[model samples]
Target chain A: MDVLVYIEHLNGKIADVSFELLGKGRELANALGGKLDAALIDANSDLATQLGSADHVVCAVDASFAQFSPMAYKNALAAMVKERAPRVVLIGNTSMGMDLAAGVSAATGIPLIAYANHIAVRDGAVVATAMVYGGKLFAEAEPEGEQVIISALAGSFSADAGKGEGAPIVEIFAAPTGGAGTQFKQLIQPEAADVDITKQDILVSVGRGIQNADNLEVVQELADALGGALSASRPVVDNGWLPKARQVGKSGVSVKPKLYFAVGISGAPEHIEGMKDAATIIAINSDPNAPIFEVADYGIAADLFDIVPALTERIKSG
Target chain B: MNVVVCMRQVPDLVEELEINDAGNDLNREYLKYVVNEFDEWALEQALLLKEAHGGTVTAIGLDLPEMDNALFTALAKGADAAKKIEGDFANGVSSHTAAKLFAGALQAMPYDLILTGVQSAEDLDGQVGVLLATYLGLPHVTVVTGVEVSGIQATVRKEYAGGMMSEFTVSLPAVLGIQAAKQAPRYAPVSKVRAMMKEKKIEGLSSSDGAASSGIKVRRMFKPEGGQRAEMIEGDADAIAERVVSILKERGLVK
Candidate 1:
């Protein structure tokens, strides 16, 4: 195998990021003139049926692989990498992927490039462009190794390119068991009955620049005037000013609202990943160089404190 | 339970970051350094664990600019000890090298749990904790939001995307990448930190080991290319608000 893409699945559904990797994996494999493979480690999920873009689907099915036990998955994936010795391995830059990627790299003694958004074959060597400094900058790196692992960020490639109609050769391998130090418990989903930001048409998002919890009233008033729900970045929710449901980011809800009104939010890449698809984005921040302006449809490089109230009043009077 | 918290200082993003003349790194000259935010949460988690379970919390980091102040603050916040890996790390080291260096330093220490930030701005690999665990031959979990200890096992809350969380029972002597603590990281009073600086000492560990030569090499560093940027709505707050309202109306978003 030349390119091996780890197929990440939860609750019998393959993650979109897995397909994205497979899409990019196919291209890299073609460039290397080798086969593209997918590693499916699940207890009972028939996820291999969906991995048609790959030439092979290596399945490691065991009862221990049911839930995401970090130790079990890491051991299994590491074993697969060592066995296959693929020149390039692609994993998603997600929570689960993060748990496994580095450990796999260490176990196999392969260099791991993370937060990679762009990967290409340059003179038979894999070059990757990775995000750093909260996505403020990009670093193009090339590892000097026969095999390299690259954990790609979500939405880096097109999912449609990964979806195809073909049957891949499936192979089953025994999953490593015992010496597992982690046991999975119940998954705690977000509480229901709160305003689902994903379903909202307009989302007024707040960030660290809101200053304090009491000041949330300003952004809340704006959300009310715009007939939208109040959302927040991770810091606001981390600070206990808002519920986790109201948070919008990589770990929060991905909202494609008609209008994403950002107040005092310096858009980090994770936050941008969630709301960049919003139809019309308007940002109010004092810092003109904030990354939020890059994605906003219209921006006010002024104090959000000043513009939020005036915008609320203007929308209310209208 | 004995806990070890790994901390790192990153270039403060609040200040303007300039690319170095080499075009492969940040210009450290005139750059402000601050503790990685997630690592602060990790330290807080370690402190909370120590407070609840009755153990010592040791803060460790690579020797970097202003790292002693951060260690002093940790001590003032109730850490039992502070250790720095002494070396010339002015330009910083790769996550791979740092993890190996940490593993080397930690081999002599006694710890039931090793906590570090899930990701940092400079960790291009963004897997220091995971790599560290692998190097130490320990089980690891990342993006953990909560941890509860009992006997030799720990039940932790690991967060996932879209506000989902899962509980895991991790065995002792494991590593965790703390995403957030139960509460915000507590602030240390300047006076307490000063007292710690006067009364306490940071132990130094020597390690001059370099990163693997075959590892990833940065070819260049550059700012993100600007896409279709937002149209600037100028004037006073009222005028900007009027323009916003007009855009809303134009898009049939408002009356």
Candidate 2:
């Protein structure tokens, strides 16, 4: 049996997620006692060797692949899948991961079991567990055949997984391409910013009800006292009251800080889904029925207008 | 300045709705729907752009009954035409899927640019614009806060953490997820509501129950428990406010 994992990267280096995928793939490969392979399609050869732990690293390299060209990347991986006929494939559930997973699944007409946090083969079929309903429910999926496709949810396993293991096995394979289907005219990169919220330990996010520009100073004071990152909801960013970089919902960054505070947010499910994994949550809102309270470890029923400044002063003094 | 605005109607998220207990299909009875809040911005931006540019504005929606109000408003705002497509909603389609669908509908009739909300009020994946570009194979600039069209390429400003903004250039046929007020959405005239209702028709088509197509299936429903109580800070309204602030500070919420 063969299980193929899709390798992902940014600028030729393996993405953090690829390691996580390897960890999950390792378990599945060991379980099936099957060879684990990876599709490493990139311009650089170094990343291919690093990801070589795969019993077979299906290498598809070309100059155009320094950055992801959807058509080229998909074509290469599809060719590998067609050739190998692997029983299952695993990918990470990130932006790139989701796109490739969907595209590949559609092309192959294979069922996609995405966002799987756990998986086990029960009596031969691949059974996967995925959290659904905004991390509110877990679905147990057992595909009927040996063939399956899955994208592992991020942060599912301990960081320890990256620490273990032998050097990746390496192999080279042919890629499918005529290059006629899709061509990237240009690749305009967003300006690089130093704020990587994923690396932050704490994120203090402000919402709309802060009452205007002056209250923002108080939020600033609080963030300084915590010596942590400060972020905002879409409204705060949209209103020109906060910078777009600070927006913390799906459009912004998906963060898992050690502590997250929701200040006056009504707790849209979209926003909550992005942050519910924070180690601790405290919600402050004037509305007694604010949805943020539903997920907060501690809730405050008071106007943010009144509380923000006071909190800032207290923290400064403390 | 030919501009295309996109909007989608979605199930109201605030409601405590459920999937039909009897099956995986939606429990439409308890569901309330809306003009997908952010999509409103996309529609508004289109109408505003058309007013500024000489070209006609056409609004396309994955036709649904509830979108009639929104489509008519788009027309009243002077959209030359409104095209509706019945699309499969259960699929976890990528913005790539949208580009595939939209590119086909738009090939014969193309625009200088297309705008969408940063994220849908429901799915909020924040990847639509990026995905669409991949499918249509156009260059895209996203997380945009401001834009200007010069020749066929666009110069756009994007905001980042710490109040930083950066500008990038994207060529035409690009998909952008517009932030609210990048350009203020014009208010629809009160008098036009009735005419819009008469003139607008929403179009819709459902794909097969492809909920599990993405391999991301919903197996069961679970709601987080929330019973821990908040102890109000003791004092008068003003004093109480002060106390709560201190609590927030104590909790590292605010300064």
lDDT of 2 by residue, B1-255 (tens): 667666666666445546567543346664566666666666666665555656767777665446667777777777777766566444334333444566556555568887776555333122345445544555554445666666767666544323344455566767766656454456678579668767665444333222222333344433433355444344444565565456545765554
Native contacts kept (model 1): 0.85
Error of 2 at A191 (Å): 5.9
Query: Model 2, stretches more than 4 Å misplaced?
Result: A113-148, A151-153, A177-203, A208-229, A244-259, A265-280, A285-296, A301-318, B1-6, B23-26, B41-54, B63-65, B76-78, B86-195, B198-217, B225-255
**Interface RMS deviation of candidate 2:** 6.7
lDDT tens string, model 2, A1-318?
678888887645576667777767777788887988878887755775566456667778777666665556766776778778888888776545644664565556456676666777756667777644334334566554557777776666543454355566666676765443334344344435457766787777888778676688777766777677788776786667765566675446667887786787877544664677787677777766566776676677777766766665655665
Q: What is the C-alpha lDDT of each candidate?
A: 0.88, 0.62
Over 4 Å off, model 1:
B208-214
Query: What's model 1's lDDT at A257?
Result: 93
CA error at residue A27 for candidate 1, angstroms: 1.5
Best by lDDT: 1
